[model samples]
Target: MLYLKSIGTPLVLVMALFALGGCEQAEKSAQQMLNQAAESAKQAIDKTNEAAQQALSEATGSEKTDKEDSKDADGQKI
Candidate 1:
């Protein structure tokens, strides 16, 4: 009985420390995953914004050039 009592307390303490360390590692991993997801989302938004701006410019540029080419009888562009 004396030998069991002497060993049991230290064994329980070691197991408790191991469990706490595992929990800490899991928390760190979860945080890293969240950070990566946020970065990907930001990149996606930037790409979408660039595409929308390019489409808008392409749609509007031709009409502007045509208007500039057409001149009035007074030799001035209307």
Candidate 2:
């Protein structure tokens, strides 16, 4: 009985240490995944904004030309 008690404490402590180490590694992995997802979302948003701006510029440019073409040389409407 004395031999069993002496070995049991060390065994339990070693098991606890391993469990804590695994938990720490899991936390780090989760954090890394979250950071990657956030970066990807930010990049997607940036690309969407850029495309929207380009489309808006093109639309406005065509409208300006149409307005100019409808005017006479004296700046009066045709």
Candidate 3:
């Protein structure tokens, strides 16, 4: 139908944009680009681990209720 075509066309355009987002070339200087990507990924993982450790350190308290309270206050899920 005409309505289906209208909705599908916009969705297709949006999907196309998303699909092209990660298609940037890895740079003419391949070694530099690879090293940059590796460093960025490493820093991201390190920050994630640091956040987890700080959350645990904050939440592991004297009693079950206190631990639960700290977790709730910090908005830490699980």
Candidate 4:
């Protein structure tokens, strides 16, 4: 009984240490994954904004051309 008691405490401590180490590694991995997801979301938002601006510019340009076509050389409306 004395021998078992002496060894059991050390064994329990080693197992606890291993468990804590594993938990720390898992936390780091989860954080890395979250960072990657956020970056991807930012890139998508940037692309969407660029496309919206391009569409707006094209629409504005077409409106100007249409107005010019409706006017005569003297700047009067046909």
Candidate 5:
């Protein structure tokens, strides 16, 4: 009984420290994962917007006019 009593206090302290450390590490890892997912989603949205704009300009025949306006007959800016 005496030996058990002497060992119990240190055992409990060690277990509590492990629990707290594990919780802190898990939270940091989860936050990093969330940040990466948000960045990927933002990139996807930008690409989708660019594709939609290109499609619209092509459909309306504005793509050719845009090319023409970029230069004069001598291949210089107008």
Candidate 6:
């Protein structure tokens, strides 16, 4: 139709410009989100390792007392 012919070209150009800007902004936002997620994941892993290490150290320390256990007449240890 003649109506489409007159407006189609300009609409296409405007749409193209808006799409390009939108894509650029989307890419920047995605990059920022990825960076934040990675940093948070790394911090969480570090904290978990620290906690595990602490728990293991504590468990090991309690399991084997620094002093040797004394034996009784029945060969039992207190």
**Predicted model with the maximum TM-score:** 2
Tens-digit lDDT string for candidate 2 (1-78): 334234354455445555677677656665565566567668889999999999999999999999999999999999
Backbone Cα, N, C clashes tallied per candidate: 0, 0, 0, 0, 0, 0
1-78 in candidate 5: lDDT tens per residue?
A: 334234354455445555677677655665555566567668889999999999997877886778778998898977
RMSD of every prediction: 17.0, 16.3, 14.3, 16.5, 17.1, 15.5
Q: Write candidate 3's Cα lDDT for 14-78 as tens digits.
A: 45555666343323334344455567668889999999998887676446676576675467955
**Candidate 6 deviant stretches above 4 angstroms:** 1-22, 66-78
Residue 31's lDDT in candidate 4: 56
Q: What are the models' TM-scores? A: 0.56, 0.69, 0.44, 0.68, 0.49, 0.55
State the lDDT at 65 in candidate 4. Answer: 100
What tens-digit string does per-residue lDDT give for candidate 6 at 1-78?
334234354455445555777677656665565566567668889999999999999988876653334655675776
**Whole-model lDDT values for every prediction:** 0.67, 0.72, 0.58, 0.71, 0.67, 0.64
Q: Give the TM-score of candidate 1.
A: 0.56
Worst 10 residues of 6 by lDDT: 1-10
Model 1: residues with Cα > 4 Å off, grouped in runs: 1-22, 72-78
Error of 3 at 75 (Å): 31
lDDT of 1 by residue, 1-78 (tens): 334234354445445555677677656665565566567668889999999999999889977878767977686977
- Evaluated against the true structure, the overall lDDT of model 6 is 0.64
Better of 2 and 5 by lDDT: 2
lDDT: worst 10-residue window of model 3? 22-31
Clashing pairs in 6: none
Residue 5 C-alpha lDDT in model 6? 33
lDDT of 4 by residue, 1-78 (tens): 334234354445445555677677656655565566567668889999999999999999999999999999999999
